[model samples]
Structure formats: C-alpha cells, structure tokens
Target: MKKLSVSILGTGFVGLCSAVCFAHRGIKVIASTHNEEKANLINQGIAPFYEVELEEILKEVVNRNDGNFKCLVGRKQAILDTDISMIIVGTPMGEDKRIDLTLMEKAAKEIGEVLRMKENYHLTVVRSTVIPGTTRNLVGDTIQKISGKELGKDFGLCMQPEFLAEGRSIKDTFYPDRIVIGEFDKKSGDILQELYESFYGDHLKKAPILRINLESAELVKYGNNCLLATKISYANEFANLAELVPGVDVVQVMKGVGLDYRICERFLGAGVGFGGSCFPKDINAIKAFAQSKGYDPRLLNAVLAINDDQAIHIVDLAENTLNNLSNKKIALLGLAFKPGTDDMRQAPSIRIINELKRRNASNIIGYDPKAKESAREVLGNKIQYANNIEELLKDADCAIITTEWDEFKILKPSKFIRLMKNPFVIDGRRIFSFEEFDKELTFRAIGRVALK
Candidate 1:
C-alpha cells in the first residue's frame, strides 16, 4: 500500500502534534509554517513547546524515515506535494469575545491559491476550533473564489476537529477516544475516514468514527468543551455549598457522586476554575456566536460568570484569612493553568496574583517547575519568580497551591511550617491532607473547612 502524504498548516500545538503522530504511524508528513525559525527548529528535531514525549517521538520519526517527516517555511509547495492538507492555525479570541478567524482565513486563502496550480484531487480539512458555518461559508468561499474549484467536484473539504489536550497531546493523538469527520460530501468524508483508519484503526479498536455534516462537526468541538467547563463550574458550586454545611467534605461528596454509572469521575475535580487554551475561549466564542444568531446562551453565560468569580473567590479566601493583604509576603505554588504543560493562557493564577496585587500584597512570589518562562511572558516582573518551591515559600505569610503539579503533591508539611513566618497554607487544588498538618499551622482549601 502506498503511504498517504499529509500537509499540516501552522506549527503550533495541534499542527505539530498531528505531523509527528502521523509520521510516527509511517505516513509522510509535511509540516508547514510561516515562521522560518520554528520550521528550522522542527527540521532539526527540536520542538518549540513543551509536550510530554513529543520531542522523543518527533526525533524518532525524523531520524528513522529518510523523507517521511519534513518541515517547510510555506504552505504552497506543501499543499502541492501532499495528498491531504489540514488547517490547524491559531484562532485567537477577538476583542468582542468571539473567535477571531483571521489566521484561519489567511491559511484558507493560501491553500486556495496553491490548489489552483495543482491538478490532482486533494482533501482540505479544517482541524481548528471554528464557529459553525465557517467551514462551508468562509473557508469554502475563499478557497473556491481563489482556485475556481467547486467543492465535492474539483476538490474535497471536511471538518475534522482536534481533541488533544496541551500536556497530553501526543498520547491523545495516538490513542483518541474517537475520530470525527464532518464532510461536504460522501467522497470527502470517505477519504478522510480511510486516512484516519490507516493510522489509528488498529491501535484504537473500540474508538468509534463519527461521520456527520460540517456544521455538526464544528459544533461538536464547542459542545465537548462547554460540557467539561460546565462540569468544573458545577463541582465548584457544590464545593461552595459543602463548605457551609458542617462535617461535609467536597472531595468525598464528589467521589460518591462520580461513582454513579451515569456520571463518571473525569472533570469532576474541583480547583481554581479551568484556564488553558480551550475551555474559556470556546465557552465565550459559543456564547457570542449564539447571541449573533438571535439565541441567548444563558447556561454558557452563567458558566463563564461562575468561573470569573471563582478566581476572585480564591483571592478572597487568602485576604479573609490574613485579615489584611497589604504588605504580606505571599507565595503562589503553581503558575500554569494545569499540570504537565507550560501554557498559562487564562490561568487562574494570573487573576489570583493580580487580585493580590490589587489588595497591596508586598511581595508575591511564584514558582512552577515548567511554566516559569511562559508565566514570565504574561507576568513580566510583576511578581518574584522563585528558582524552587523552597525559595517561593521562604519567609512567606501565606501559600496557595494553584496548579496540581506532581512535585507540589509530595512536599512535606514541615517545609511550609518551618519556612513561613506565619505558616498559613491555602490549598486551591486540595493537594494536601488537612489532618496531616500540625495544630500550629493554618490550613485552608477550596471545598473544605479551614483547619488550624
């Protein structure tokens, strides 16, 4: 069997992951990017961002196969050279809170221009998280206008949304729960299905392949994220209620709630609300998109409202515990939105730190194993960056664990007791056991009663 060739546009998380995963499966992959530096680095077997096991797989694929994996500076040649082209460009949030499709449109225009020069049939898939009607209207119209090609006749178009999380992208790509292909026509859908089967069919025995319309495919991405975001917010709400009632533990309550067959325990863990690349943006975009279509997304709006308030609530816990935040040396244990990845976009730590600053905290020190560099980009000297956890907690009045990194979980309670002047700990992620701490130490956690 002749191996399928694929071109991935935009060398960000999704694109690069897809390229390497496909190449690992013995398919020829052309990773297309506008950034020459990024392309050069990938070509040399270097990954631009930190993803678990991504660099090793990328290096293995690049070295094992002679020309199976390649990174190029532009999309034109890559489009002409490959059998399939996947658009994975960044769709940043606009000022109005809707998804800004500027990068997606630019990639579409470029793909259309390149398609004009090629004669063979090719499949163009939108793998980015876009609003519904975009694949059929904006992307299809732009490509058809420039290439003079008709969808389902001269070429193929499909919406294959990616579901890989930031930290576990490689694992998710290699073993996805399912594969969704939303096509303009039967032929396009069939082609994409065959390609995916070639790579993942044997590995994912039980994972279903869903074939649906373009609009449904686009909406599925938003639907999946919104539901997860709702779950997190719901858990937080329950935690708040549990805190008021005596002898109630949110973790134990949630554990029993999750044991029910209907609701499995996945995103049920309560913490400072979710904040990464997807959940917050997708919820806001869908809300804005729904409003534009003359429908009010009340549930989604409430979810956003709850999340925004949750971040502030963490700061309030710290302030109330200390009685005054002014000139207090506080320590933030985690900076990333979650564990495993360095991405800090919309991280709850950002809001919590900013709130502490507003309350006149004298010195806010932060430390994260992987996110320090990325956090520095957003924080920019506003707070002190600690070389290690000890440095962050030393001489601090209060300590908050924002992200649940493994290193933070193994810390001895004695460290916090001996290092801090006041020895107060606020556990945002419920990382420590309340009973483990000594009576002299002050301990507080979200969804649990404060212990002294």
Candidate 2:
C-alpha cells in the first residue's frame, strides 16, 4: 500500500489543524497559503490563531524533522507534491447575506492551474462550506477551462465538509463523530475514504461515514448547523415564556422536553444566543441561498431574529433588575463567544456590551481566561478588562456570566457576596446554582425569572 500525501489550501482552523493532525498521524501534508507570513508561521510550528491543543501537536509535527508537514507559499508546487489536494479556504458572507466564493474561486483556479501541469489524476476535495452545485458547476467548470481535462478522467472532485468546533478542533479531528465524503464520482469517494482509512487506521472503525453526492454534502453542513441554531433559538423562545411566569425555569422545561427520547439535550441550552464562526454565518448563507432559489426560509429568518434579540434580552434583564443602569458598575464574566477558543467573531458579548454602553452603565469591565486579547479587536476600549475572575467581580455592582467558561463555573456564591459593592448576579448561561446563588443575593438568570 502506498502512503497517502495530502495538500491543503488556506490556513484557517480546518486547513491548519488538518495539516498538523494528519502529519501527527504520520501522513505527509503539504499545506500552502498565499500569504508568505502565514506560511512562515506554520513552518515554524506557530499557529497564527488560537486553538486549544494545536501548538503542541504542530510543534511536535515540525520538530520531527520528517518533512511530514510543512507550509509553502507555492500552492501549485504543494498540489504537485501531494496525491489529494483539499481546498479549505474561507467562503465569507457578503453584505447581501449571500455566500461570497471569492476565495474558493481563487483556490479552484489555482487547482486547475496545477492540474494543467500535472500528469497523475489528482483528487480535489472541497473542505470549505459552499452552497449546493458550487463543486460541479463553479469549481469543476473552472478547473476544466484551465486544465482542458474532463472531470472523472483527468481529476476527481469531492466535497468533504468539516465539522470542527473552534475550541475542540484537534479532539474532533482525532475522534470525529462521523465522516462525510460528497463525491463527484465513486472514484473520488473511494480515494478520499482510502485516505481516511490510512489516516485513522483503528479509529476509523469507530467513525461512521456518509458517502453521498456533492449537493447533499454541502447542504448537510448547513442543515446540521441551522438545526442546531434552531434548537438554541427554540430554547430561547421557551426561556422567554419561562420568564413570564413566576419561578419557571426553562432549564427544567428543556430537561423534560429532552427526555422525549427523540430530542436529546445538546444545543438546547438557552443562552444569550449562538455565535462564533459557523452557526450564525451558515444559517444566514443557507437562508439567503434558499431565498435566491425562490424559496423563502421563514424558520431560519425567525432563528436569526430570535438570536439577535437574546443579547438584548440579557441586557434588559440587567436594566430591569438594577432599576437604572446610569451608575451601575457592570461586570461581564465571559467575553468570548464560547469557552476554550479566543475567537469572538460574532460573540454575544459584543452586542451585550454595546447595549450596556447605550444604557449609560457607569463602568463596564469584562474578564475571560483566554479571549481578552481577541475580545479587544471587537470591543477595543469600550469596556475595562479584568485580569482574573476576582478582579472582574471586585467592587462590581453586578456581574453577568455571559459565556459558560469552566473558570466561571466554579465560583461560589460567597465569592460574589464578598467582592462586589452590591452582589447582583445574572446567570446568562444558567451555570450558577439558583439554590446557592439565591440564598446569598439578588439573583437573576436567563431561562428563569427571579422570585420576589
């Protein structure tokens, strides 16, 4: 059996992680970027972005001196060297709420350019999230124009959607729940599947795979994310209703609902809303795609609308609780969209902080274990940043636990009582124990109303 060599385009979460992890698994990975600086950083085993457990593996992979993985600026050379080339570039959303394939188009052009020079039938995998028909029509046609070769005979195409969470990407990559390979043909699927077989040898037994056609794979990514977003919005809607009645906890309601065997409790937690890289972007893209195809997706529209209001709902809880935000020292417990990663792309904290500023909150400060620096990019000097959880709560009038980071989860009620000028707590993630927190001070939370 010949060894598997893979080349990846782009150096985002998927591209970089896939390169390092595949190399860590002893597969040769030639990762390339248009940016010389980014390529340099990867070659030096430094990750330009923050992801948990990436640097360790990357460093190990680089230090092996095995040339298993190394980033290059020459993407064409990178493709020439590898048997399978995966396009993992960004497909950003435009102001029109549609998928912008500028990066993908560039990658496809590069792939076609490479194929024109190459002899062997290469496998081109689209790992980036794209709309249906993008692989065959946009990417394939472009490749054919440049290379002057037929699809199945000259080179193969596969749409392999990546399901990686920002924080837990390495673990997710190593222990994927499932594998999906959307193939242009059976040969494409077979080649990609064989590569996975080599990559995950024994672990491949644990992971199930879906070998489907191109559009299904693309839509599967959107469907998976949109449904999760809907679940979050659904829980938020229930949370809103729960807030109307005295002492009604939507946490309890969700627990009951989740017990119905069909709906297992996963993304059902009612929080400020869903954010970060994927959920918000995918929903908007797919919704826009559906609209362009002459079908209005009203449910997704509602999902986004509900998500937008959630941050405001949290701020509303704070304002109503304190009576006036004119002079309250607001402390935000978490700044990142979620725990572990320092990505604040569409974090709810941004919306929450903006709302706090609008209401004339005296002094707003925030603390997150990892996201402080990343938060600064979006938040700038809008809010003072606390070095630790204690400093965040110290002399604060009230604090809201926005993202459920593990650090905030351990803080006892006594800590809040001792640190704050007046201990008013809003558990945005329902992480605090109502039994314990209520016994100490005025406690409010999302999904449940405070008892009078």
Candidate 3:
C-alpha cells in the first residue's frame, strides 16, 4: 500500500498543496508543471500563492532534502518515477460559464504519452473538479487511444475528487471528512484506496472511503458544492428578508435555524454573497450542464439569481445611503473573496467596483491584509491601494466592508469615525455590530434593519 510514489501534474491550489502534503508525510512525490518560475519557487520552499498553514510545513518539507518531493517542468520522467499520477489540472469556467475540459484533456494526453512507453502498469487519477462522465468518457477514451492500453488490465484509472477549502487545504488533506474514489474497476479503486489507507492510517476510522462508479464520483463534487452554494444563497435570501422586517436579525434567525439536528450552520452566514473559485464556478457549471441535458435546475437558477443580484444590491445600498457616489472617496475594507486566502476569482468586490464605475465613482481605494498583491493583479491601478485599514479609511467619504477579515472585525467604531472624512459605513459582510456602527456613524448594512 505504501510502496508506491505519487506524481501530481499541475501547480494549481490542489496540485502543489497535495504534492507538498504527501511529501511532508514521507511519501515520494514528483510534481510536474509548465510554469518554470513557479517550479523554482516551490523547489526553493516558497509557495507561489498564499494559503494558511502552508508555508511553514512546505519550508520544512523542502529543506529536509530527503528526496521526497521535487517539482519539475514538463517531464514524462516524473510520471515514470511515480507509480500513481494525479491529474490535478484546472477545469476552468469558460466565458459561457461552462466547465472547460481543455486542460483536463491536455493532461490526459500528457499522461497517455508517458504511459505509452512505460513497461510497468501505472495508475492515473483525475483529481480536478470536472463534470459528470468526464473521467469515464473524455479522459479514459483519450488515454486509452494514445497508450494502446486496455482499460482495466493494462493500467488503472480513478477519479478522486478533492474536497479542499482554499485556506484550510493542508488541514483538510491531512484530516479530510471522507474520501470518494470513482474507479474504472475494482483494481483501480483498490490501488487508490490502498494509498489513502496507508497515508491516512487512523483517519479511515472516522472518515469512510466511498468507492463508486466514475460518473457518480464526478457528480459528487458538483452536488456537494452546489448544495453548499444553495445554502449560502438561501441564507442570503433570508438575510435580505430580515432587513425588511425591523427588529429582526438574520444572525439570530440563522442561529435558531442552525439548531436543528439536520441543518448545520457552516455556510449559513448572511453576507454579500458566495464568491471565490469554488461556489460560483461549480454551481454555474452544474446548472449549465443540467440545462444542456434538457433538465433546467430551478433551484440553482434561483441561487444564481440571488447571488448575482447581491453585488448589485450592495452598490444600490451604497447609492441610497450616500445620495450619489459622484465625487466621493470610497474605501473597500477587504479585496479577497474571503479571509486567509488571496483568491479573488469571482469576488463580489469586483462586481461592486464595476457598478460603482458605471455610476461615475472614480475615487476608490482598497485594503486587504494578505491579498494586496493578488488584488493589484486583478485591480491593476483601478483604485488606490492603502497600506492598512487606517490608510484606506483615511479621507474616504464612505467605507464598505466587502470582506470579513479578522483584523477588520477587531476594528472599533471610533477608528472609522476618526479616519474617514464622512465616516459613512456600509457593512457588506455584516462583521460590525449594527447597534454600535449605526449609533456612531451614518452606517448601512446588507442585513438587519436599522434600529434607529
């Protein structure tokens, strides 16, 4: 079970993170990526992107020089060295908001070329977020065509979806809730399951490993993500309703709703909307995929409508509060989609800024404790960047809490009152207390009707 080494293709969040975590566990890991610069950074013990609790473990794993982990650029040799190859490539959402399998197909071809020449039977696992039937239909066909290998006898294939949160990827990898393996056959599933059983020795006791057909495994990731997104959208819908009824807070409403034995309180936070790489993209793909198959997902459509409207609603809230955004210096508290990550893929802040720009608001400043560089990449000179919270709030006519950073939550009302020219605040994240902020400044929030 523990005899085999692993090769991960791609340097995306799941790829590099899984490679490093596996190596840290003393398993031999050879990862391949096209990005030479990112490879250099990874080999030097530096993570190219920011993720919580990644760097410290990564530095130790790299410095140990135990030959457990090494990232290379476009090498079939890496695949040759490892017994298992995990294609962790990106399945990006195209402009049409559908899951694009270009990268997935390319990765399969790369592995197929490697497997063609190899004498030893190797296992290939697709660990990327993909639509149903992708592993069995698209990936399996391409690999078999290139390698001239029999499906179950020549080599192995598995689709193991990773359920990793961006900020807590390391922790999730080490102690995941469950392991879902969609295998080509019993042989393939057994090999992949053995690896996990070996690596996560005692974790199997708590987290059951589910072995299923490839299509079911692929859809599980989408179902999990879509349901979570729906919960977020559902909470948001209630949060908005709470605003209409005075003396009602969604926080209290959800806390009670969460007390039920079935409904957990994980994604029920009333906020601007769900963003980042997973929720929006996954939900959209599954919805589009379902519609293409001639079954329209009414719930998902509603979820998307509610989420898309959230950003516009926030901008509308700001306009109503400030009477007009023209000639006003607006400050965005956080730029990243969420805290402990620099991921800003579909961040509501971008939508809000675009709406503000449409309304002719030119002076916009933003600050994020950890996402400044990535923010700059996405928002290149679109707005002034502040060195800190005080810097962003300083001389600003209105402040919008776009992200709920820990540092931003600790901020007192007096701080914004002292810093801003107008001291007008909009709580998009609902981090600050409505009672405190509404008492101190001309404050407006997404949820919770004003008590004054």
Candidate 4:
C-alpha cells in the first residue's frame, strides 16, 4: 500500500504550485526548499513569488489543513516524514549551454542519503525538465553511490516532466493537455499512475497512459519545448522578411497560414522573439545533448542566434530613431516576456536592457502589468520602473514595446505619442494597427511596413 504522504523537493514555482494542487485535493504534502527564508515564507502560507492565484491557493491549503495538507520546511522533516518524494528542482543551463545538473545532483544525493537511513519503499519521481538518460546516468548513479543500495529494490524511480505555463500554472496543472509518465519499468509506471490517479478520478481510466522508457520521456519534454521555440523562430524569420517585401503584412500572412489545419498557430506571433525560462533552457539542453552525441547542432545554434539577434536588433532600431539612448530617457513599455504572470526568467527584455546599457542609455522607464518585481530583480536600479503605463512613458523621449501584453494592444497609440518627448513608437511587437497612428508619430514594427 502506497501511503499518500507526499514530499516535494524544491519549492519554486512548479514545486509550490504542485504542492498546493495535491494538498488542496486532500493529499498530505510536505513542501521543502533549500533556502530557509523561502521555506519559512511558504510555511506561513505566503507566496514567495508573483503567480496568479497562488497566494489564494496556498492560503486555502494552509489554513484548512484538516489533516490532509501540510507544508514542511527544511530537508530533515521532509525526507523523514514522506515515503513518496517528487523532485522539482531547476536544471539551469551552464556557460557551455549544457544542462546544469548541479541542483539535480544535490537533490539526488540528499534523497540517496535519506534512502540509506530508511526502511520504507521510497518512490522518487522527477518532475524537473532534464535531458534523456539524465535520470539513469546522474540521478540513478547518485542514489546508488550515496545510498549504497541497489536500484529496483530499495527504491523506485520515474520521470514526470512538468508542462505548466508561467501565468496559468494552476490551470495547466489541474487540466494539463496530457500527462506524461516516464518510468524505468511497469512497476514504476503503475506507481506514478496511482499517485496521480486521484487528480483525474473517473477520467483516469480514459487518460492516455503513455508508459515509455525513461530516456524517451525525458526527450519528450525537450522535444516539445524545442518545437514551440522553433515555431516562434520561424514566425520571426518570416516577420523580419515581410518588412522587405512590399504589400506584405506578416500578421495577415500568419493569420492566413494559421487558418490551415496543419499549422495551428500559437507561438507564431513574430514579435521581439521568444523568452521566459522553459523555451530557452530546453532549447539549449537539446543543443548540448546533440553536441554530446557528436551531432552538429546547427539548427539549434541558428535558433538561438536568431532570437538573440532579433532582441538586440530591436534596440538598434530604437537607438537609430531616438539618435542614441545615452542620456536619453527611453520608456520601455513591457518587461515580462509574456503577460498573465510576473515571471521574467530569461526574458528578451534582458537583451534589450543590456543593449540599452551598452549604448549608454541614460535612463529607461519600464512597466509591466504583472512582472514589475521580477523585472526589477533582473534589471536592478539601472532602469526606472513605472507602476503604470502612463507613468512609464510620461516624460520619455521614445517608447519601445518588447512584450505584447494585452493591455498594450488596447492602449491608444496617440496616448503614448501624447506622453513622450519625441512621440516615436518602436513596435517590437506589431500590437497596434498601422492605420491607427497619425502622420506625425514615427511608428516602426518588426517584419511589417512602417507607418509614418
């Protein structure tokens, strides 16, 4: 009998969100974090980061524990109490663009040590995104070396990749497009299915139970992310070319292309390029994995090169319009890669901001509906933060829109023109219609005809 005590290793966005989901569903949860400060915050039912409805969910779980849900701080209590553990630690990319397994190694070593002192059959499930064979090579090896116990006996392992978007994490969790389980064997697969069964209830019997080998499962995550990244890159490539072609509006072109049944459009918006944590990290991991296998990752290299170029290229256009950013106050309209969440992990805004710095842009006014705090953390005091859109663009020479927040789309271009010193708008994202702008304001968009 698998006791329903669940311990989550790593309480970042995915970890905490998963913990809340399980706990709310009457599953006892002990969420752990490496940092003491983070653990305490989570224990108090306060969300550590900016996520939509996370605080409300955490509060509900913590306040109404009723014996089913609980938040356990520190490593000792977490490992000691639970028989089923889910590792949700991050696997950051290294300087060489390889998957940095440092956090994963540490978590595995700790789990191995915990296993060494335990007698129960521990089910270790990895919910982190990793390369193929990472579990067998790194995690499995670490457990064997540290626990001094043979695999398939003392403990069972499986890979459960996360597929949550930053903003809609909770929604995606409860209603994931599909649930993927990568197990070492049928036994491990069955164990995971049982654990996640309650979430699906009667639908469990009908849900796709893709029981594949560990490596295939791992590759699935990277493959999914890379494909999405590829779509964005392809879109941007066309968007850039559209500018040279007369009478070509990339937006319309994409809309026409997307109408086809084959290419259902989602990441096809050709803006300032794709950003955020998953796409960039997973793409690099794939590239590294291919390089390790002695395969030339030329496509991956191009994908990254194009994204970087597009992001930096926006700044170049902005600089040209404004005649140098140095000592020129520039208002950057959007900060987060996408709207609906305050997560700025690997945002294209980083490249744009860095470029601004390089060109000695004296001041930058920035605003995002959700990602202000995260943007500040990444940008520091270099750029000024505006709590509102009007405040951000007010008194600025020119404004650049990096992120395509829905708010920006509805915002009147004349209002931005009214607020700025130069009244010039560089639409990194073609969020506004060219016809909407007046003749005086300079409006430029990527891969589209510039409206004078």
**Per-prediction TM-score:** 0.98, 0.97, 0.98, 0.95
Q: Give the runs in model 1 whose Cα sits over 4 Å from its true position.
A: 438-440
13-111 per-residue lDDT for model 1 (tens digits): 899999999998888899999899999889889999888888999899888867889999999889999999999998878888899999999998998
Runs of candidate 3 with Cα error greater than 4 angstroms are none
**Residue runs of model 2 more than 4 Å from their true location after superposition:** none
Residue-by-residue lDDT tens digits, candidate 2, 1-452: 88879999989889999999999989999999989998898888898888999999999999998989899996889999999999999998788878899999999999999899999999999999999999988898899899888899999999999999889999999999899999999999999999998888888778988999999999999988999899999999999999899978999999999888899988899989999878888898998889888999999999999999998898888888788998889999998899988889888998899888888885999998988888988888899999998888998888998899988899898899999999999999999888789888989888887676
Q: List the residue pairs that clash in candidate 1.
A: none
**Clashing residue pair totals per candidate (backbone < 3 A):** 0, 0, 0, 3
Q: Which ten residues in a row have the lowest lDDT in candidate 3?
A: 443-452
What ranking emerges by lDDT with the best candidate at the front? Answer: 2, 3, 1, 4
Ranking under TM-score, best-scoring first?
Answer: 3, 1, 2, 4
What is the C-alpha local distance difference test score of each model?
0.89, 0.91, 0.89, 0.83
Model 4 backbone overlap count: 3
Q: TM-score of predicted model 3?
A: 0.98
lDDT of 2 at 441: 91
**Which of the two candidates, 1 or 2, achieves a greater TM-score against the reference?**
1
Q: Estimate the overall C-alpha local distance difference test score of candidate 4.
A: 0.83
